[model samples]
Target chain A: MKVTDEILNRFIDGELNSEELKEFKDELNNSRDVQTQLRALQAASVSFKNIKEDSPAVDFTSKLMLSLHKKFKSRRRDSIFIASVASIFVVISLLIIVYILAQIISAAGPNSSFQPGLQVADIFEKIAQTFVSKFSSSSVSIVGTIISFGVIVSGYFYFDFLKSTRSN
Target chain B: MIKLTDSEIIESIKRGNQSDYSILVDRYKNKAYSLLKRMLKNNMEAEEVLQDSFLKAFQALSNFKGEAKFSTWFYRIVYNTALTRLSTKKRKIEMEMSSIDDYEFLKSGFDIHSNEKEDTAKMVNELINRLPEKNAAVVSMFYLDEMSCEEISNVMNLNVTNIKVLLYRSRNILRDMIVQNNLVEELR
Candidate 1:
């Protein structure tokens, strides 16, 4: 079998199997061409080893770290912004739900039946009754649903912000 | 001083010890710079792209799964960033280079006759620099970085067979040049 340059290349790279290795050795012992080719390849390989790696400027690390620091700061600012927006959204949603409840209670004339100040339990019952009564109104249901969805979405964003901050 | 593995360092960075990243940066900077320098053939551009590659790796670190070695992943970033820079400079070639005829490929930039007085290493470096971009990267990564063919395949996004072929062909060219110049003895 004729030994090709590819064979020699694989041989030098130690990619040959045990059978191929034996055949290559036999060929190497017999052929001057194979020997010369192997010699040249080995020389080239050694020359490649002489090529040194290039170094960057002295400040490369410092500059990269500075950029990373900026990136972290920006990321923190974004997390803070998300948290603030989500907090504001949750607060607004709660206020709207409270306002809707108060409007329903006032419309029900609960103050006339309860006298001046009502117990917490009575107030909750009146709010629940009025809420159930108005539950059939599509506008009321939608407003309630929109507020709940907004709050849930805001909670999700807030959770995501916490996760991101912790990971960073 | 017990040295931490790349994964350890990455975990530390992910855990908010971002400063530990400098260790990785220092570790890979030179070898990666060598790769970029050979790929771009411009020291200034190589350094600039090296920085960009590092920043990109840092930004994308959270997405790195440990399926491959860190060197493999990092070099992939470097190789791709260099390719992008090359394309922006309007010098990017097809990554699938096996179809190009060897003669046409050799005729493009196989000039070894220039500067005959340089030493073997310098001559070898010059010859590698004169090769096609992908070919030069294969030689550099294979030898200078001491990366295996599989690792180079991962970085270059080529199949292992193609990488082996490129490596063999490139080393053969260097061998032929060394033989012709009678630099084989000096190299040994």
Candidate 2:
């Protein structure tokens, strides 16, 4: 039998069927070349399996954990930074959108022919008049209430931050 | 400490329990390290590659679809990391090995018996490392980890036929090396 290397490889890997395996075994028994090749393959496999000293360092996991911890922290910081930037951009965009809408409504309201070349002083005077007229008694009370609410919210967050920092 | 399956551990990690990832690190460290060590043949490089692969695996966990076993996927990363490092160092083997006939391996004068497995095994550390990285990887994955050809194919990103061919080539090369060194008799 003109055995090929591929066939021998398959034989060693047990990829051959019973008949082929039996035939190969008979040939192996008869052939010193087959025996030598098989021994070489077997030795390589056995050596790797018997290589008990190829294990990792005992502190390997600990070291990996440390690196992983730093990675996780770095990832978290990046996420937080991205989120914060996105939130700031969203807030700024919303403010710009609201301001643009307000300007459109204001320009469209009383001054039907509001021109672009209006003086800065005239623009400020118009804005001041509008604010003063809009700030009636009920509006003033509403503003007071909003200011009080803002103070309480800020105070709550400030105290919370102080408490957390102190505990730390 | 209770044992959890890889999927379960992954689920826990997904639930914001990052510390649970240490379990995976602990589980795969040795095998990953050994494979890297065998491939790179450097302790510091092996350790660096091991750590890098683990970090990469953890970061890419969300991309893992569980189509393959976690070990295969993770080992693939380890293998790739080692490959990249070797390539960067320009020490990667570029073999133009010709067709090795079956009879070529069969003409060996060395008569190594399987009973001398220990003697043969002793020569493997030095002998196996001399193999080209690709064949060395295939051999280690096949014999050391007992990975199936399909799994090795998945990890190595090669088809099953190619992996089989690598295996054939690796076995022949190792056998040839043994004959050249006359270690077959020494190991006898």
- Per-residue alpha-carbon lDDT of model 2 for B1-59, expressed as tens digits? 87899999998898889889888887778777768877787888999888889889888
Best candidate according to TM-score: 1
DockQ of 1: 0.62
- The local lDDT score (0 to 100) that residue B118 gets in candidate 2 is 54
What TM-score should be assigned to candidate 2?
0.70
Best by lDDT: 1
lDDT at A2, model 1? 76
Question: Cα miss at A76, model 1 (Å)?
Answer: 2.1
Instruction: For model 1, state the Cα shift of residue B86 in Å.
Output: 2.3
Q: Per-residue CA lDDT of candidate 2, range A29-123, in tens?
A: 89998888777766544455665436667787777777677666666666776798699999999986676556656775675876544543455
lDDT of 1 by residue, B1-188 (tens): 99999999999999989899999999999999988888798999999999899999999999998899999999999999998999987777543443323524443443445644455566677767767778889988988889988889999999999998888878887888777766666678
Q: Which regions of candidate 2 deviate over 4 angstroms?
A: A36-40, A86-93, A100-168, B93-122, B177-188
Model 1 chain A TM-score equals 0.59
